[model samples]
Target chain A: MAVASSDTAIRTSRITRAFIYLFLLLFALFYLLPFGIMLVNSLKPLSEITGGNMIALPREWTIEPWLSAWSTAQIGVQPTGLRPYFINSLMMAIPAVILSTVVGALNGYVLTKWRFRGDTIIFGMLLFSCFIPFQIVLIPMARILGILQIAGTTPGLIMVHFVYGIGFTTLYFRNYYAAFPTELVRAAQIDGAGFFQIFWRIMLPSSGPIIAVSFIWQFTNIWNDFLFGASFASGDAAPMTVALNNLVNSSTGVREYNVHFAGAIMAAAPTLLVYIVAGRYFVRGLMAGSVKG
Target chain B: MGFLDIDNVTKSYGAVEVLHRVDISVEEGEFLVLVGPSGCGKSTLLNMIAGLEGITSGEIKIKDRVMNGVHPSKRNIAMVFQSYALYPNMTVGQNITFGLEMHGTPKEERDKAMKEVAQLLQIEPLLTRKPGQLSGGQRQRVAMGRALVRNPDVFLFDEPLSNLDAKLRVDMRTEIKKLHQRLGTTIVYVTHDQIEAMTLSTRIAVMYDGYVQQLGTPKEIYDSPANLFVATFMGSPAMNVLPAKLVERNGALHAVLTGAEGQEIALRIENAPAAYQSYKDADVFLGIRPEAITDPEGADRNARNIQGFTNGVTVTEPAGADTFVTMTLSGKDCIARMRADADVHPGQPFEFAVNMDKAVLFDPKTEERIG
Candidate 1:
């Protein structure tokens, strides 16, 4: 009788497990379906893309659209490729990521360890900046970049991104350092390490996971930003996102769906590559930063 | 002048005072343990000594040098925190030599110091491992090694063994005592466990409510606690305090206790301290250790004023080596420590002996020891 009861229980558990797997499969398909369409369409010619069958795999795949998007694609009056803007995005993002992360780490160290009067209020103000929409800062940022004589240049875009990105990077590191034990800092101080020495030797070494998180987050935000890129840069200094937008909305040409899709995919590649490479650390940083010891 | 002096030190956070006018002096090579229950300001006092916390008032001198505003590193002290606080990223060897490295000690000298500390702590095999890979006891040893490698003027341990399990805590406590004996470095250790304070300290400072209740040798604190707080806080199974009337009977002082059954028992006081004479005919709390009230067979027969009385046993708790027998005295439950073999049954009359000479008298109103 016990064996019969156990058999029934096993059967019920098996059915429940099968249902769980089926639900997860559908959930995965819901997210992967759009990327599948983009991939299949980007491989096809414009005629097949404009055809009614959007979900079907392409009959004949070709790399011509990707080639055209990289080299001969028209963005504004220039017949130059997204190659130049891609380099422009890299120049802006690399320096922005490095500077913002360093500043954020220093801010985190000071706010958490060397806190003085009204430090929390200052942190709160900095944290409040992270939630402000870009639209709110668009006009002021443009004037500030113009006054600094860096407008219409990549440096101006880099500075704008750095200023806007500081809030998020600071928030990441502040929360991470808050969870970090204060005793380690105290011990380092008692070991005769000064402020910068402790930061360089002790705090920075332990910041591996958070560094990946902040870099990835800031890189993705600056790389994909279109509003800041469009308002602050022009012509030769335009970022890939701005160039991609111009490519899709060019008024003179017949609509080229495949080239636009290819351009979109190319613009997203760096962020996707970042996530693929350091994705594990991103999740670990989130978990470790949120949970206090 | 002592080796380390904390003169009238007080600590206040805003309007709230945590440690009030505390005074402590440590002679060189003395193992002083600051022990109290939680929130007793023992750790605060230790932190002040280490220069980790700022003193609100008074002066702290180390080696006759005023250290009021000295940095912790410049004060030449090393601390072992309760959490061990080992750098998770560094190996045990790096953790030990970090202080020396910061001071720009030569690599060979740093390596020598690290090797000596590792050998002294028996942590040589664990030197290459990160703190994350170590067990609690191993982490504790590495923390001690970090402090030992510095060879500072004083070693401060802030409840370093409190994180370990019971068996490991006892074992580490012995290891620490042996380490102190061999090194003979002036040490200030803080712990909430009185047993650790009693067994490891040359002198124990029993603190309560931000005040030093008593500071003396372990035997002195155990035998002659300053007040009800020290009397009760220092002992496990706590001293039993019973209200009694100090009556003058035929030119002799007697503590008259009325049991729950309305029966009165008078125990004579012998060689009472001079302070007890003024409390005649007044109510006082008779403080006696559980060991002083034992089974008649195991009682100290040679004690100066041994008195035996019959009372109804309320409960019997046999704790392996000794049985804790509870009975009623002055309408309050009083626990007596007896030999495990003593046949004690609840609700039955039992004969328990009391050593009156070892007993203490406290004024009921103030709870301060009178004799």
Candidate 2:
């Protein structure tokens, strides 16, 4: 009798587990549904997309929309493409990511190992920058860019992103470095290593995970940023996000929904690639950075 | 001039002082151990000596050179941290050779030094492995190897063995002592464990509350502690402090202690120093080691100050070789190390002998030793 009841209990637990998995599967599908529709519609011709079966696989599959989005799409008065804007975004993000991450790393090293008076207060203020609304800085930033005479250029956008991105990068690096043993720095000092030597040989080598995290975070933010891209860049200097916005919102011609979807995917592709390649490290870095030693 | 001199060092932050004006000097090739409980500023003093911390208001001289404002690398000292502090990203060989590389030593010379130190530490087989792959003892050896490769003017150890288990700590302590003996390099070690200080150091500085209470040889610190704090802090099962009245009896001084049943047991203060004369007829603390009070047969029979008495034992703890017998003296608990073979039981009277020549007395008011 005990065995029979235990068997029933096991069956009940299996049924509960199955139900839970089924619910989770449906929840996951709920999130993936929009992307699925975008993917399906992205493959179809304008005629089929207009027929409005958005979730169905394309009956007449074509790569013309992708080609058009890449090279021949009309954004603003220019008929060039998102290709230049994509390259522009890369140019802006790569240097910004590298500069901000390096600065943040140095700041983290000094804040943790070579601490001065009121260091925590300084860190707190730097962290506060991460929370300020971007709208509040837009006007002053525009004026600063105009004053610097680099307005509507890629370098101007790069500068804007670097200045704003430092707070988050510093936050990541500082919290990650806080758990690092200060004794290693002291040991290196006693070993005759100077400040930069210790940073280069001792710190940076051990900063792989946090570096990935910082780079990904900065790259994603700078790449997907429409506000700063639209505000600080124009014409040839416009980033992919701003170009995508122009393409989607343009009122000059008939709406090409497939082209819009393909352009959106292209704009989202780099960050998605980064996440897919290093998603595990991203999570690990976030966890390790937040936990104190 | 001494090899290393810490003259009137005072460390303060804002209005609070963590280390008072402290002074210590050690000759070359001397092994000095600074010992105290936690929050006693031993680590802070070590940091000052290493030039890792500012001296606030004092001069630290190494080999007749004032090290004030000097960087740690320029100070020519190597320290083995309590955490080992091995760079997790580097192999043991890289960790050992890093100092040389930073100093711009040639590749061949760096490899030679690394090999020599690694062999000395018996970590040669493990040199290629990272710190994460090594055991605790191996990691400790790697840390030492890192220091040893530098051949610095002085060596500083900050409780390097405190992280090890009991058996490993003992083994490493002996290894450190052997290494020091072989190298004869001047070393300044810091530990809270008095036993480690006693076993490994040529001189021990007993500190308490930012002050160096006593600085002497291990035997001197053990046999003649400076005050109540040093006396109580430097012994295993610590020195038992019994409240007693110093009474003058027939031109001699006697410490009058009451037994558990209110009976008086007068222990004669034989060879009492002249300083005790002023403390007569006043309450004092009679400090005695557990081994000083033992079973009659287990004591030094020919000692001039041996005194035997009967006391009621409240507890008996047999620890293999010697059984610890607890008794009451002047309304306080006192432990006596007795022979394991001695037939003694709790709740019964036992005969015990105290070697009074080794006993010490402290003034009740100042807690300072009274001769």
Candidate 3:
């Protein structure tokens, strides 16, 4: 009986592992197909792309369109081939991520740990702001920005992102911090840790997942934004999203589909690379926040 | 001067006053334990002494110096938290030495202190491991080591064993008592466990509703409680209290114990308070420890005498070493701890002798000791 059971267990283990590998292989192809199509289309010449179906790879791969997308096309002709716009997007997003996450952590720390009055009202207000539609407030916000004379500048975009980013970041941190034992904070105080000392030494060190979550959220929100970029950006400060929109929607002549696809790929590359590199952190961050909170 | 003095300390959160005019003093190298139930401000008062909370309107002095505005570090005190708040990131060695490092001790001296405490706590092998990697007992010992390495003037422990399992709690309690005896440091520990307080404290401060109800040696708190709350709160199975009236019978005093169906058993009051003699039938409360009222054969002849009384058994619980018998006396429920050999049974009437010598009398109105 023992020999028969051992034989059955070994067979089951082999079959289970095979099934797992097949499942993962299938799942990978499901996501990679669209990215493959985008790459093949971008590398193809306009004549071949216009003549064939969407998913087909080009018979002859050429670097002309890549160069055109980088230099000669209307999308690329502005300010060192849309490089300044790429810089603008990064400049706006990094600081916004930093500021929002810092404010969020402090807000969260106070909301959960500090027993002061009116803290509930403040937390409620932050939660409520996350539900307010950006469409309803865009026009009034633009007008206000115009009056403040920061309507179309890079700093203005950063400030807007910072303000809008606080709601989600604060929620993330507040919920994350609620799981922390209050006894630890009291112990730190009794151990001679002051306010900032407690935050830096104890609270901040344990904040890896929340920081990753906040960073990813803020980066995606700021980098992928088109409506805000169109409304707020002009001239050299226009982000890559605005440039991508203008490239695809231009009505004066027949569209250069190859350059357009290349530009699209270029515009989407930074976020794609970020998602790939920090993908583990992204999933772990969300999972940690869900259960830990 | 006492090493630590708390004079008229009080605490209130907004409209709620939790502690009211609490006073406690501990001499140098004394181990004081504050024990109480939940919602008692024992933890709050300990926090106040550690300078984590503000006193409502009183003073706390350590070593003849006012500690009102001094920061916890400047006050030169160390505390072991209830949760054993080891720094999650630091290893056990670092957790024990972090305070010393903060106080700017030399590296060699810091390592020496850590080694000494680790050996003392029997945690030398766990020094390189983080708090998350250690067991509950290991973390507790590490917390103690952290507090000890500081060599503070006063060590504060806030329910440090409440997080452990029962077996580990008992083991740690014994270790803590032995540590106190060996080091003889001035320590103020807070716990809700009566056994822990009884076994570890040089003096136990019984707290209730934020005030120190009584402060004395364990024996004093056990034998002569200041009030009904302290009397009942300090003991296991608690003290048995029954209501009766003080009556005068023939030139001697007696307590009239009324039972069901108009059965009145009169018992002698040998050392009756002078105030009781004035009122012939004044209502009073008789407080007796569970061991006081027992079978006549099991009664200790040399125990302190209260007014002599007799009670009828209504239930019997034999606990091997001793039997807990519950009875109806003076129209209220009373419990007594008797010997296992005392043949007690429920539903059968038996009169148990009461040792009135150790009994305490309390005024019904104020719940304060009458004599």
Q: Best DockQ goes to which candidate?
A: 2
Give residue B34's lDDT in candidate 1 (0 to 100). 97
Higher-scoring candidate on lDDT, 1 or 3: 1
Clashing pairs in 3: B304-B357, B304-B358, B305-B356, B305-B357, B306-B356, B306-B357
Model 3, DockQ value? 0.53
lDDT of 1 by residue, B39-109 (tens): 99999999898888999999999999999999988999999998988888899999999999999999999
For candidate 2, the TM-score is 0.97
lDDT of 2 at A14: 73
Docking class of 1: medium
Q: Report per-candidate TM-score of chain A alone.
A: 0.91, 0.93, 0.87
The complex in candidate 2 yields a DockQ of 0.87
- Please give the lDDT score at residue A285 for candidate 2: 92
Please provide, for model 2 over B1-371, each residue's C-alpha lDDT reduced to its tens digit, 9 standing for 90 to 100: 79999989999978889999889999999999999999999999999999888888989999999999999999999999999999999998999999989999999999999889877888889978999999999999999999999999999999999999999999999999999999999999999999999999999999899999999999999998889999999988899999999999988899999998999999998889999998889899999999999888899777799888888999999999999999999999999988888889999998889999889999888898887
User: Could you give candidate 2's per-residue lDDT for residues A1-293 as a string of tens digits?
Assistant: 34544354345677888998999999999999988888888889988988767778898899888889899989887877689999999999999999999999998888888899999999999999999999999999999999999999999998999999888988998998999999999999989899999999999999999999998999899899989988889888999999999888888888999999999999999999999998899999998898762
| TM-score winner between candidates 2 and 3 | 2
For candidate 1, lDDT tens digit of each residue in A34-152? 87887778889998977758898889999888998899988888888688999999999999999999999999989998888999999999999999999999999888988999989
Cα-based lDDT for every prediction: 0.91, 0.92, 0.84
Per-residue lDDT value at B173 in model 3:
92
TM-score of chain B of each: 0.98, 0.99, 0.94
